[model samples]
Target chain A: MVPAPSPTPMGRPSPPVPARAGIGLRHPHVQRLLDERPKVAWLEAHSENYLAAGGPRIVALDAIRRDYPISFHSVGLSLGSAEGVDPAHLARLAMLYRRIEPTQISDHLSWSVSGGVYLNDLLPLPYTSEALDIVCRNVARTQDVLGRTILVENPSAYLSYAASHIPEAEFLAAVAQRTGCGILLDINNVYVSTHNLDGDALRYMRSLNPESVGEMHLAGHAVQHIANHQVLIDDHGSAVAAEVWHLYEQALEIIGPRPTLIEWDTRVPPLPTLLAEASRAEARLSEFRQTRIHCYAE
Target chain B: MLSDLQAALRTGLLGRDDAEARAAVANGDGLAPDARIEIYRNNVFQSLVGVLAAAYPTVANVLGEAAFRTVAAAFIKSRPPRQPQLSAYGGELPEFLAALGATRHPYLPDLARLEWARNECYFAADAAPLDLGLLGAVPPERTPLLRLSLHPAVRLLGSRHDLVAIWRERLGGGGRAQDAGGEGDHYILISRTGLEVQMTELSAGAFTLALGLKLGLTLGRAAHAATLSEPAFALEASLARLLSHSTFTSFVLSDPAEEVRS
Candidate 1:
């Protein structure tokens, strides 16, 4: 068995992000984050947004990084692509990682590119032996290059492939077991996929290895109609759905308190609105923490 | 087999070869496989259209949303982004616009070019400005041998139409397209200073000199080129202006041996 690679040493020792709620950092909220310095536990930035050589966004992130521990959530890695990972993209990410030294880093368990054409959407993969082998290889290679174990988020799939024989939870668990990477369990994604595919969200959550879950994502999804059927779209445009929040509470109960993030990308509300959402998650986290403390005392 | 599946999916998402690809997807939940794939198809086009709209705001403003979406969809079909970075996706859009034959609006291509340059300038690499003292330290006699380097954020755009006027009007929230006046050649200089990317209209001679310098010409050669283009070109004044704008990042004394070999 190949030994897991050690975590890459950042230039300076980064402050670990607390197991509390945070908000996904957006461009419009940069000023508020800097000026007001909100009381969120941390900020999570899309790794691809800061890949540019220079920009106000990069500068803003630099200032914001000083005040809060950051997590780099990437969408462009295409970890499940059959072509494997692109070396150029990896190098660009490495450059940004070396500069920012984010506390946590992650990408999705979906493919976005094939045959050199990047679709820019998290397309689902067939959960067969072929795909599992490819994903495990890609995850291992990415960890080896980044010199750190990255958290792989489960994709909010729109469709299922006919060739998929393995369950999604088992595939993710197997990937983590092989690559020594953690899972960035997206609760909203599970809710969305289950609603669309007529599956059991709670069973899927229960199937995951709780120790392998390092972070959790809670985002707003839109509901759309198709042939008089309701399908949830992971648009991240509005407030977190009540059903998703209920599922999130259940997840906290099962997975324990993790670094949860409130992701509102499209039609993003004012800073206070996102903060309110983060506050809701933080309330639940605090409740769980208090319960655990009381139990230990007893 | 994975490659074939991806190929089929790509074609299907673009609304081509739907039947074969739809068969690969499991159908259930009262939604046809084709309808399910259509969601991704619409999303792929709409999201990419949004990217182009954001990058080329003036173009989208000039063409209006519906027409802009039409043109963007065509462009995406013809030239999808190969890289994952969307910011660097639309480099060929100006050429695409030219090929689209917007003969009525002749300046559309140039306006798009300007917008593309601004898009690039916004994300160009950062570099420290060269110390003016270094240029001052060079002996007057050896100044002619000095080669100046422009910042990565610097871009020069020469257009036959008055693109700056059209871009300015659209950027200022002018909903209606006004007449851009008579056609005349324009020289524009784009550079990022501090945090803001600034666009300035430059004289023909200044543009010539900047272009020459960007091509690795020595100060003396670039000045000669500038004067050749415009007899009244003031080399000292233009150099002062360029330096004040922080256009150049560094300078070096050209190696005589390398110069001779070239």
Candidate 2:
């Protein structure tokens, strides 16, 4: 007789995702992933999109999970909310994580919900001591419930707050240091936020604790002119910018190789285009690995 | 101070006032603080509006893009998503549309309800259908005490308009609005079989039986309810159809001993 399903982790010993490049799994590309079963290292899906109890998408993801390691990249955890994490949301995510058994689980450092209203966009946070305390508490609570560590990604912001005394990188490091959580560094966000806010992207990259970075993300951003000033919006619509690619290489040089994901949420191109982007990231990762080996030999 | 900052940001994004929130945002090189905040406000509303459009394509198509945007923006402002799961966010939209009373087509609300039902069915939980052989094993006398549970994905919708036809037409089914004829009742049974969420129009008897079964009535009582609604209701045929469609997930025999204890 089949055993009754339990809420505990299945303890299925699946292979861990290699420190190679992967693609963000979107609904448009599910059938392609199923049909082709590409040679990519892993697939990351937005956790909120797959929170449904059951569907073809969930079924497809389950089928695909067998072939590739999956990562749950959440955009709606609202980790920076002052009111703390929502129990219901956390419970649902926990349920999903139990089912999917993702190789990695991550959300943004920014808050998306406040006062019971979910804005559905990653709003920037003021990196004050108080904000840091709240985020760390929320992260701890999240990790405690999921029974696993979650990586928090940095946000791509159009604006910063006057109240923020601590730097973004410092705040992220503090959260990791305090909560024992890892960081999923999105290189495009670092490039965009620093460019828009007039900070040094390289400096921010160097400030982060490399050991805390479990994964990296590379996505395209759109440059928009607001009030005659160039503002790069993290739209994830087009090809990865050359500048962002340069920064990714720089980040690899600093932080070493980690599991990287190519996120193209808006105007998602055909599977081949995303695959090509993943290939580009994989090539860089390989090149970085080779350079490291050569340097070690020398 | 954190609460104040978040409150100001909320007001700045959703309300007309940005003065308080603008003070909190540090000004960039050349862009005004409010302009920067405007980008976030635009993103928030646009993304939520896009979600509503995706959930209710028929509503968007019927209202047209410009009008749909107006409605979506209004809906977002009034009933912002309380939960992070956006797929389940727009369930209240049918009532909101009905309250608007701006459409020439009064059937729009029902169409929206149908779409929402379809959306719910699309994401509803998976379940295994009841085994016919299990029913065969039960003594014939005990069949009347068996309470069948509908599948989690099964949804019954009753509309005063020919909602199926209207929804199909909006989905490019090629039927004109007039072809739906005058107002008539429609009973729709939506269930997910494998990967597909299938919608079917149920007969009066079958609808009554399904509705009764959903309400926790036993098989004999549900058949009685079905026959009461439609004299020609054939219990065997309806049972066969429901079983074939994988409507009922499982059933429990209502024990006389347990009933007495209760």
Candidate 3:
């Protein structure tokens, strides 16, 4: 568990992920990618979904990893679990890491399990000092074990904790500061949380330690009407809303050019449609870069 | 506070009478306890139902979505997920169905077990088939005492009824429902090779032989076990059947001198 060098961009060549867009590699799209080797910067996979020993999922990942730089996005690590991260899940992830050698590793800043019972959904956590401390310790332990500074993404929430004290942005900053881990800012989550909770998404983005921000996630959401209350669900089953994409553009301004991933998990469109969504992000990044360069010259 | 906070959240989410979640005016939409509690309740049940569906698609198909949801709700209330990976969540559903007079799906448990085994085999590791090259190096006389090792993906199941046939019938694989009817016993050998699951009907003798080898029995002892289960069992034929199915990934020779590490 020797730590790989501090990933704080300490004069190392930024990893191989080109400052471009990539699509989340779902199981349905595996065969297409294997057949044609689609023209995306890299592919991202849900780590837990591919933990099989010798199945088609693993085989597909093996073949795709050779052609495209893969990022292992884990959902089951449960970094915020009060029970702490599951050890066997971590061991299985470590084994997969050794096998695939993904370019980046990431998990969400939410708890999916409690009291040894897994809820499977990324349940929201109460933002408080005690929870922040627990999350940072677990992130540090995970980084120490994985030998890499894993990226912790924000979770889309439906409700807020009554006993909470700290703000979500401050909590994320504190976790990053304490653990020396990086952030995978999911702009869709920020938009979903801010609009529903009535907070300033822009200021929330500004509060983060930009240096620690390594990657960005943009996904789709479904609006649910419960008693005339509009709660946006981060249901990755539709097109990326215009507002979230605008926030993604703003994120590019703050974080500069990081590896952006267009994630669509359920009701995934055809391979070409996903690639088209990723291309939109690519176009935005290039436009941002050109504008930044022209303004610098001026 | 840490553990208590978790317990309170679980209690609130599970909607148990012992919920420690303090009802506050600032919680839920418009801060209503029923609505707040309802949010968690919906999430818990919905998630548990989703896990059951993933683990038991055949059962879900058998019962359809509505009844499956009812059964899933009951299963969740009766037995929540104890493991982080939801793959292991529905272990008690089959037994639970057997006890509950309702639902009337008699073969649900065995069907659930079959789906669970399919998942297990799906995630099991890939291995090279038994390299007889090593066996070729072993001396001739001591080979009779060799004990074979079954692959991790190999599972032998014996039942008093045609469980696999019933499962196939539900899957519309052309198996008749009558095939599972009547009071006759059945044996099956399930294995995964080349990323696809393979299930073969096994005779009593073959099942005995597989069970023995799985338990580390030597060749002679495995044959004896098969004979005990089926008197007319032919030892050589059963051995050849297992080998042809590529069950043994490696073997331990009877004599230490003639042993070749596989």
Question: Considering every candidate listed, which one attains the maximal DockQ?
Answer: 1
Score candidate 3 by DockQ. Answer: 0.46
Among these predictions, the greatest TM-score belongs to 1
**Candidate 3: how large is its RMSD?**
4.1
Model 1: CA > 4 A from native:
A1-11, B176-178, B255-262
Name the TM-score of candidate 3.
0.90
What is each candidate's DockQ, to 2 decimals? 0.77, 0.76, 0.46
**Residue B168 miss distance in model 3 (angstroms):** 2.6
- Give per-residue CA lDDT, model 3, range A1-298, as digits (tens): 1123233223432246667898999888888899998799988898877776676778878788778877889988888877788888889888888877777889989887777776667767788788998898889889878888798999887667677788999899899888888888999999988876777999999999888888888899998877767778778889899999888888888778788899998788999999999999999999999999999999
lDDT of 3 at B221: 75
Q: Which lDDT values do the candidates have, in the order given?
A: 0.87, 0.88, 0.78
lDDT of 2 by residue, A23-112 (tens): 999888888889988788889888899999998888888899889888889988899999899999999998888888887789999998
Q: Positional deviation of B205 in candidate 2, in angstroms?
A: 1.5
Residue pairs in candidate 2 whose N, alpha carbon or C atoms collide under 3 angstroms? none
Model 1 over residues A1-298: C-alpha lDDT tens digits?
1123224354457777778999999999999889999899999999988888987889899889999989999999888898999999999998998888888899999988888988888898889889989999999999888878899999897789888899898899899998888999999999999888788998998888899999999999999998898889999999999999999999998888898999999998999999999999999999989998999999
- By TM-score, the better pick of 2 and 3 is 2
For model 3, what fraction of the real interface contacts is kept?
0.47
Q: How far does residue B145 in candidate 2 sit from its true spot (Å)?
A: 3.5
Q: What is the TM-score of chain B alone in each candidate?
A: 0.94, 0.92, 0.83
How far off is residue A10 in model 2, in Å?
5.3
Q: Give the TM-score of chain A, superposed on the true chain A, for all candidates in the order listed.
A: 0.96, 0.96, 0.94
